[model samples]
Target chain A: MRYLKLIKVFIKTSAQETLMYRANFWVSLLHAFLNLIVAVLALVILFGQTENLNGWNLSSTLSLLGVYLIVSAIRNLFIGPSLEALVGLGQEVWNGQFDFTLLRPVNTQFLITFRIWRLFSLIDLFLGGAVLLYSIFQTPQSPNLLAWLLFLLALVAGILILYAILLAFTALVFWNPGYLFTWVFDAIFQLARYPLGIYPVGVRIFLTWIIPVGVITTIPAQVISGQTGAPIVFLILAASVFLFLFASWLFNKGIKQYHSASS
Target chain B: MNHRGGFALIKATWFSWMQYRSFFFVLAFGWMIPPLVALFVWSAAAGEGSLGGFTRGEFITYYLVLVLVNQITYAQVNWTVGDIIREGTLNHWLLKPLSAIYQALSSELAGKVVYLIFVIPVGLLLAILLKPEIQTTPINFVLSLVATLFAWGLRFAWGFWLAILAFWITRADSFLALQDSLVFIFSGMVAPIPLLQGSLQQIANILPFRYMVGFPVEILVYDLSNKAILFGFLMQLTWLAIAVLLSRTLWVKGIRHYSAVGG
Candidate 1:
């Protein structure tokens, strides 16, 4: 309840800040539009050659693209903006202003994560949603209620996994203040844009198990698109849980390390 | 304009880049994966059958070659130019004895050298592992080198001009990002130019973006007719000229428009 109140305050503050810059809205919309065009054009060109790629037709690929866009937008909207403020600038951490954040009567992670919200990030979500709906319509398979449920679950799991990776990277900032790992994460996100079935066997295994980029958007997209089963959902959910726990543990350890380093 | 000063700057930047070698490697790894994914997808799509006149081996060669070409031609300094101008750092650059282009060139050269240190070894490794069919002629190889150099120069000039617009529009970064998306679609990064449909291929042919990354790859991977090669060279020179002129115009106009505000 307290965090909810805090998030509300943050959202209100963000809304005011966003409103002050109306140009951001247009720029963000154009960015999403440009991204959509590129993704769609690529799909069109790829499908022009042959029909199905590892049972992924143009529609399935479009859905995958949609998921990729939405997931990336989610990162931009909340996790990226906030984590960047924390670890990227290192303004608070490097200059020891993060001391003030620690002294605050709130959960530091929660405070950091929820404090910044880019409302313009919704433009990508909206665009992604449109693409998803259109692609779903084009797809021959109409998934049942169970599949939809599983798809939503897998989506949540994917987002959690992403956050876990981000949190772990930010935790490392306590030790190495320079070099944002988020750039590395941004690069990895490109791999997740395509289905893992395309890569060689070695890469497939790495993306699926090591980084979980394979499962991030692709598995959820597959489940709902009728390409895979509900069992994959459980697998992803388990991975998400394990990753979250590990990331939180690492973050706590990093805080301890920070105190020791400063002392 | 001072060659000795430029060499010193370049050397300094190169050494500075060595400090952040790991970060660049991480970035290069991220960059390498997308083309790898495309390589696999196209190979799978071409499975035992040619797609758009490209054999499975040909698809592999195209992407592998593209990985090299794209890596070599990519100039991402425009992403920073907006920040430099917006923050009034461009003022300091203007006051420098040597040309500001030399400073930018220093960073550009340093980054490329740092990138290639990782990119080449990885390329050779992939060449051995993936066994992409090697196709080349002595003449085509020489032409590819020339085309690749021009591509880098053209892309950098265009992006730099776009970045200089920060004097007139604070949202110049947004447009630079949009230009990147255009390149992603048209530069044969996603698919070979021949794979695109009639109008799309035409657009790619007309646009300077194809010359930026795709044309060099095409020259190396496919046996183009003499006419095609001649047409490509013409396009490359024309675009390079236009980019230079546009950048010069923007540089002269933007300086008059830019002044440090309130600080």
Candidate 2:
């Protein structure tokens, strides 16, 4: 019940903070829309060059790009801002701000997780949906009910995995207060821009097992394109759950090391 | 021509970076990731062959050179300008004997010098390992040097003008972000402009984005015809002149409405 109240407070604070900057809100929305347009132009250029690139047709590639953009957008909406905030939190903790957070009758991890949200990032969600729908309309092959269900399932799992990864990276601040790991995390995600098939087998293996960026977008794309089976879906789900649990454990361990500036 | 004050300021900025050497390294490493990833992807696509008339070695050389050129030409003036406007820091600059732009330009140059230690060695190492197809002609080298200087001036002026837009809008970061996204697409960060489709390629050529990085990098890596090289240099100078005139006009006008907001 306390956790529910904490979430409510976080949402309220975030909304209020966003409302404070009306100009910023509109500017960020326009920025996101421009990014979406650029992505569309890129797709058009890619298809214009050839009907198929490396055996992936225009529609399939567009579907993959759509999934990539949506996953990336969702990550930016939630995890991205949180990660940046975590860096600031790391600095603040080093300078004794953790004491303030600890004094509150709220879970520290939960407080840190949802402290800030760039509400304007919802533009990416709308843009991604539009692109996906446009691509589906143009495609001859239609995904059935099962495909849709599995794709949504994989997507949720992917989001969980991404959240876990971000949490784990944030928790690293306990050990290395410098917040240098953010760059590494960003670089790992950059690999997801292309379909996993374009990468070598070794890279694909590393991304799947080590970084799990592949699950963030590729698995969902595969499901939507009807390329994967139940086993792969099960694997992704299992990994997502494992990662979340592991990251939670790490966060708890890190919290114990927190030394309040007040003391 | 009493320039001692300006020289001292530039010297102080350079020395400050020396005191914080690790920060420069961290920033250069952060900046290198995107271009490095692009190099790998393009290399993989070329795959012991050629794509769009660019061999693997040529692509590697092009991007390696691009990294250095981009570092040298990058202007953070917009960010600084926006900060000054938002934080009321511009009042200090306005009171100083030197123009605000001189301070911004000096700091940017100092940053470039600091970044060189990290960038140059890595660039040379990559060039040696990858063996990028570069034309080693005296005239080409001279032209590259000239193009880089012009590019720096053009980018700095352009960024300064964009920063001046903060006088009109509080949220200028969004516009800067949009400029960066355009740079990534049109400045040959993803791929060569020539490799893009007919209309996209034309658009890239018509814009100053290509002159900012691609033109110099291309001149270094490939044997451009005399006509093309001449036209490219002319275009760079033309853009630089336009940007300088616009920035000068905007700065004069922006200061009139500059009601410093916060500190």
Candidate 3:
């Protein structure tokens, strides 16, 4: 409960920073719309040639893309911005300014993970939700309330999986702050924009188990499209919980590994 | 342009950038994922059957070659040109002994050299494992190389001009992001140009985007008529010329505008 209020305060301050750059909102809106158009255009062209790709059709794939956008927006909103403040290009750890963050009264992980935000990404969140809604309606059978509940559960799992993965990568900054470790992760994450089944078995296994980007987007999409079982959803929820705990442990280990750059 | 000075600058840039080769390699791998995803998706779609005149083997070859072509022509340097202009760093470039372009050019060449070190081996490994089928004459290969050079020139000049707009507008990077989306859609990254239907095919053929990365790959992989290859080259050269003109004009005008603001 205390953490929730802290997040609200963090968001309020971030909102003030965002509002100072009004043009950025318009730029972000345009970027979101352009990204949507590109995604939809690609789908239109792909589906135009073949009715379905592997077992996934255009609508199901669009659902995956929508989930991808939502996950990405959520990352951009807080997960990306906050962690990026610590370890991104020319950021805190790079410049030895992270000592200031460590000196704060709050927990280091909690502060670093929630203190900064790019509110402009809220535009992408709305656009993604709209796409998901539209794609859901386009399906032959609309999701029932239970399906919606499952979808939300899977979506939350997906987001947590992504967060854990990013947090693990962010923690690597302690070992080597010069390299942007998240970039390699970003490359792998791009694969999540499509259904995992479309990849070769070997590649699919790697993305699903090693990186789990497949679990981050494909499972939630599968739930929305009514292609997944409830057990699988709960299984993913458990897996995400485990991954989060492991990542938190790794972050704490990394915190201990941190040596002040200034000294 | 002083050829000796430019050569020296590129050497210096390459050695300086060697320290960050791993980062560039990761970025290159990220750039390769989209085409790799397309390759797998199209190959799976074409299992036991063809999609839009492309067999599974042909799809494999097309995207394998495309991975190399896309990496070669991609203008990663242009991403920083806007920052250089906006952050008052352009003044440093202006005072350099070599032409201002050498600053951009050196980084561009060094980045390609670094990125290709990773991209080529991965592409070759994928090709060997995937077993891409190819039947191209030496003449076709030579023409494809020439087309690739033209494509790089067109893409670099076009993106440079867009970045130069930072002298007038604070948010010129938005335009760069918009251009990337357009290129991804029209440049046959999503699907082979041959697979595109009616108006979309015509639009892609007419746009400068296809001339950037897709035309060269299409030349090498697709069995096109002489007239079609000639037309592709013609369009590519025309766009390159136009882009060069625009880049030159924009730099001159933008420098005047920038100096006025500073003065």
Candidate 4:
């Protein structure tokens, strides 16, 4: 109950801070919208040139693109901004200002994570939803109800997987107070632009097992396209849970190594 | 005197970058992926043959050269500008004896010098391993060098103009991100300009974006007639001139309205 109260306060504070800069809010919305348009146009151009790139047809590719945008939007709206804030917290800790955060009765992680909600990323989520729906409408064959349900489940799993990955990356801040890990994360995320099957077998396996970027968008996309089965979905869900737990463990471990600059 | 000052600034920046040896090495490793991935995809598409007029060897050469060209021409001043505006660090620079633009240019040059330590070795390894169909003509090489320098100037000026928008908008980072996405598509980062369809191809040809990465890379990989090469150089110069004018106007106007709100 205390945690819930703290979360509510954090959310309210973030919303107020976000509203203080109205021009930034509008520009960020317009920027996200333009990004969505560009993604859609690129897909349209690609599909126009070839009915099937590699083995996947237009509808399947579009569906994959939808998943990519949705996953990216969610990351941007919540995880991305939160991770950035966490990094700032790390920086503050490095510079001896963490005492202010520590003095508060609230959970430090929760406070740091929810401190600055980027309201503009919500625009990205909305645009992503619109694109996903539009792509669904354009597809000649509708996915069954079960498939849609599975897609949602897979998306949840994907988000968990992404969160786990980010948490692990952010944990590095305890050791190195800079943007190194963030850049690596960005590099991995760039791979989500295309279906994983197009990559070499080694890369495909590495993305799935090591970085897990493939699972964030591709595996769920495969499930939605009806290219995979129950076993893969189960494996993905289990992996997501395992990874999250592992990341949590790592975070706790890294915190013990944290030497506050104030000390 | 102005030209000499500019040259000195560039040289100073280069030397400063050498001081942060470890950071530059890490950054170079981070940046190597995009071009490497592009080369991998293009190679796969070409297989044992050719695709869209580019053989496997030609694709390798084009992408590797592109990696170098992109490194040399990248304008990270946009990122710095956004950061300075957000953090109110611009005030410190404004108070300095040197122009903030010169400082930015110097810092950028320093980074480039440091980055070359990594870029050069990896680029050479890829070139030798792949044995790409590279053009060794003196005229093409000389033109490419000239075009690349002009392209860097144009991109830096354009990015500086965009960054100055932070004076009016806090979340100008979103616009920069959008610009990056557009450049990825239009600047032949993913695929060559010739591979794109009719209208898109024309847009890529006419836009300054192509000159930033593709034009110089094209000069390296293919033999263009003197007339074509001259026209490309002219286009690059024209865009650079426009960017300089835009940045000058924007900077003057933005500083006039610069109400430093936060530190």
Best by DockQ: 3
State the C-alpha lDDT per candidate: 0.86, 0.79, 0.89, 0.78
Ranking by TM-score: 3, 1, 2, 4
| Residue-wise C-alpha lDDT for candidate 4, range B139-247, written one tens digit per residue | 7788788888888998999899999899888678887887888787888886777788888888887888988889988887776677877878888888889999999
Please identify which of the two predictions, 3 or 4, would achieve the higher DockQ against the true structure.
3
Candidate 1 regions with alpha-carbon error over 4 angstroms: A260-263
Please, what are the lDDT tens digits per residue for candidate 1 over residues B164-255?
Answer: 88888888888887888888888888889888899989999999999999898889889998999999999999999999999999898888
Considering only the true interface residues, what is the Cα RMSD of candidate 2 after superposition?
2.8
How far does residue B45 in candidate 1 sit from its true spot (Å)? 1.9
> Candidate 4, which segments miss by more than 4 Å at Cα?
A1-6, A88-92, A96-116, B2-12, B21-41, B47-49, B81-101, B125-136, B161-181, B223-227, B245-263
Question: Which ten residues in a row are the worst by lDDT in model 3 chain A?
Answer: A178-187
Q: Write the per-residue lDDT of candidate 3 for residues A11-58, one digit (tens) a residue.
A: 999999888989888888998899899888888888888888878999
TM-score of chain A of each: 0.95, 0.90, 0.96, 0.91
TM-score, cand. 2 vs. native: 0.91
Task: Provide the lowest-lDDT 10-residue window in model 1 chain A.
Answer: A254-263
Q: Best lDDT goes to which candidate?
A: 3
Question: For candidate 1, lDDT tens digit of each residue in A96-165?
Answer: 7677778888888887777799989888988988998899889666878888898899889999999998
Best-to-worst ranking by lDDT: 3, 1, 2, 4
Give the clashing pairs for model 1: none
Note the DockQ of each predicted structure.
0.72, 0.38, 0.83, 0.37
lDDT of 3 by residue, B72-139 (tens): 99997678998888888788898888898989999999988998899888988998899999999899
Model 4, TM vs. native: 0.86
Clashing pairs in 2: none
